[model samples]
Target: MLRRPQGNLSYVSGVTDDPLRFVTLSQALDETVAAHGTRAAAIFSSEREVMSWKELQRQSDDVAAALLGLGLQRGDRIGMCSANRREWLLAQFGAARIGAVLVNLNPAYRSTELEFALNKVRCRVLILARSTAAGNHLGMLRVLAPELDQPGAKPVLESRRLPHLRHVIVLGEGLVPARAERFSDFLRRGSANGKRRLAALAAALDPDDAVSLQFTGGTTGAPKAVALSHFSIVNNARFAARAMQVGEGDKLCIAGPLHQSLGLVLGVLTCVTTGATMVFPGPDFDPLRTLDAVSRHRCTVLHGGPALFQALLDHPELPEYDTSSLRTGIVAGAPCPADMLERAVQLLCLDELTVVYGMTEAGPVTFQTDVDDPLELRVATVGRVHPNIEVKIVDPDDRIVPVGRLGELCVRGYSVMRGYWEDAKRTRDAFDETGWMRTGDLATLDADGYCRIVGRVRDRVLRGNRLVCPEAVEALIRRHPKVQDAQVFGVPEVKPEGRSDAKPEGNRGEDLCAWIVLAPGAAASAEEIRAFCRAKGEAEQVPGPVRFVAAFPVTASGKAQKFAMRASMVREMKAREIKTA
Candidate 1:
């Protein structure tokens, strides 16, 4: 009984007249603390650390003072290369206090990716963890800039490679390199006088100033730096807080990496803007840990991608966990598959599970389902346009398509990012003449204003929530001596069920597949190629299955037809009919 609109226009604006307050993140934090100082602000369950609003304010002030003592100034880029932890939150709010842009570095990034992020943003101060489960972060940093490990190293690293970097502040206690300062010592250097100065600095700050930079996977090449302002993210977080009906003492469990917008903006800032307690299950997403944290903290809300929710539901001990406290949660970054949403509602105690849709360029989210909406709407669509935002579905000719017609989705609002940092050409190309940010997602708007994302118009691969650029991975693979040419694409995969009677489950997710034209007579196995990619690239970027191809199907323009490759792989896999179940 769906009705279709008669008009040719396909634009829609959010109906709410909710005021978007203009305030810096530091100001927002101050206001929250003033209102709820005694309330719990953050809890790191794994570390057994808890902080009230007052404690968080004091620690963040000290961290800001330490950064100022390190000679960082307003508008300076400060990079945080660590996983989720108490210190990460400290750096996040601390940088906001002084107007320093906090650059989010993915924890999974290797030496090459780390080098690119550090140098690309011209990070003056770099904050990092000693190491992560993946590998030694400091060791990799030394590999990128070996000057740190060498004797008689200058107090300030004089690397021609990273000329803008002036100081390295290592987080947590460990063997501190002589070239870097320990986080504890750095914090001790801050005095009472510096805290007084921080007040004046906060007073002079403007909401429009660029306060953070997030890297997004590129369509043309490597990832680009997305610059966002305090104004943009604050308003987005406020809208989200309102949407989720967040309130004081409402514990929110977060399992995603803090580097992503989901964790930092939606999870952290939403709690700060509202008066909710931010809970971190662990440094990374662990289904059991997340469930445990929710049960122990009596968390009312949880936020993560679909994969995490699925993992939680699929856990063998799911029935044993007391998740009755969970009333609402957000499942984003991927589609909520068949039966998954219902299962989440029934088993996880998430009766008000909502689905959100957005990209990094749009300050993360512009569409989300209401808590009271029907389960069908919550799973089938990305919900209506958010308040204070405008959306349109346009044809290739820049004209608005009729409702229910598939077209590229474009958005216009305060939530839109300022621009890609320092890339004028790309920035200009991202927006239309009328200032609409082209989202590159093919979608259709129904007469009721609900949007259904169909597919992507751009040539990119999405493995879970991670945006993987085939060209970027291909470029890395091509560097192999035996690989003459390479193309990476997403191939639909199926996972075998453990039971003999169960049918093989279609993952509805993708696996990275690489088709390479090897050098004459060169032979390579899938393991060898994966290992090579693992050493040189990110684990996510490494192809799961390697195929040796003599040549690729190309169009008349000599462009590799990735769609053809995907189709061929799908057909080949289906023909094998391996007993995955």
Candidate 2:
């Protein structure tokens, strides 16, 4: 039902006659359990465990009762800092059941980022793994809250740095610090009275109540906590589930981290609405583990970013396992190259692999390709807007651009987030006066309503007098047979001596740089890549300096960190200049 009423204008709306479900996530889970009690609700492949809908309900109920017994009340903020695990899922639903807002903390975050997030949201309780690849999370907590290490420390945390934090729950079998509670013991503390209270709280919960605080990718600045209400995410998941044609029989292998909206909202919530089986390949993304999960569980759906799929396709043991069970999936969180999409379709057997375009603020999904869409549409554009959403491409002056014209994408609909947590100024700045949430993504709307994302507005590289779109350049570079992936960005050009007319510090022009990850067993020089781009066309499109890399820096959600790449390149260039001088 996507339509462009005025063919000359860039405004489009996804019209749907179906009424949106107005229920809390707790209510949604209850309905699904009633309908599919015996069906498998979750499968932790790494742990060799499976839980049916009925079992899932019982475990989540235990989690809710435990939190209630700890004196957590409605609207209290509880933080979860861990990789994908059964406990993370339980905490997500449990907090929602008691109307507590779960603040998703990235497991990759270090002490500085972690401290800021907890204090910013005023988290009363935090649940974390003992350790991760990042480091010892429990150790970091001790550093931040030295009171935890004091003699005769009580279970309640008292830290001057993190004043709002009162309780710390550690996951893992071991002797926890004196001020922390073990997850096992914490879960066992639930009482019959607590269970009754949980039920009463769930019954009184409203669909509009905020259920989770998902942090943004923070590519531009400090990560903002985006508050999402049950009404927003549930409907968003329902629309996405409908688009993917997910059902109770389908098993989904989720490679994305549960801390992000991609995992919790799209992956988990979508399954809750459709009764599909949710599969966690492992705590962190491992191609081998993911493939084994798909082959072993016969997972019908898969979800991850472009980098994840690229790793799977490039794995040496790819042919050793069967991926034919992957009939449908979602490739999002970054710009997807056409070559990568084609490879996923042929190698992973994801014929219905869709491309989703959204940010954390848009309930994580605003536009998504349909299952039956053409390969070209799925590869080239993030398809039409989701039902009950409105989209428009606007110029700098806020005028709607014409179809086929590039402009900033803006959206307004039920799926948009309430706002950044406790940041009124940022929330006000995120939308227009009329309530349209500015996406900050440069994109073009086709006559058919397909959206081709150009790149980030700030990510455009200005070389000489021309502005270069890094996404376009990266797409061209990825077509090289020797290249597996490419990230293109602007590096500040060193100012020549006595150049008084040079642009100011922030506005200085930049030279195009390309960081390429070579295809396995393939070798190529920087000059060869430049020559390849030169032969293709457009001298302006060719990158000035090409550097080979094993991989590009990426966020937890798997989006390439172009700003980080740009800064690193600038530093390298400056060092070179100093050595030459």
Worst 10 residues of 1 by lDDT: 495-504
**Model 1, 10-96: lDDT tens per residue?**
788875578788999999999999999988999999999889999999999999998887777899999998888888888998999
Q: Cα lDDT for residue 568, model 1?
A: 87
Residue-level lDDT for 55 in candidate 1? 95
Q: How many residue pairs clash (N, CA or C atoms closer than 3 angstroms) in each of the candidate models, in the order given?
A: 0, 0
| Residue lDDT tens for model 2, 1-581 | 34553668999988677678889999999999999999899999999999998988889899999998889999999999998999998898999999999999988886888998999999999999999776789999999999887656458888999999988999989998888899999998799988888778899998989999988877756788999999999999999888899999899888888887779988999999999999999898999999999999999999888888999999999999999888998998887878889999999999999899988899979899999999999988899888989999999899999899989999998889999999999999999889999988999998888988898888888777887888889888988999978988888866555455656657867878999999899999988999999998578889877899998887654557887888888888778757655
* Model 1, global lDDT: 0.83
Per-candidate TM-scores read 0.80, 0.92
At residue 247, give the lDDT of candidate 1.
Answer: 82
TM-score of 2: 0.92
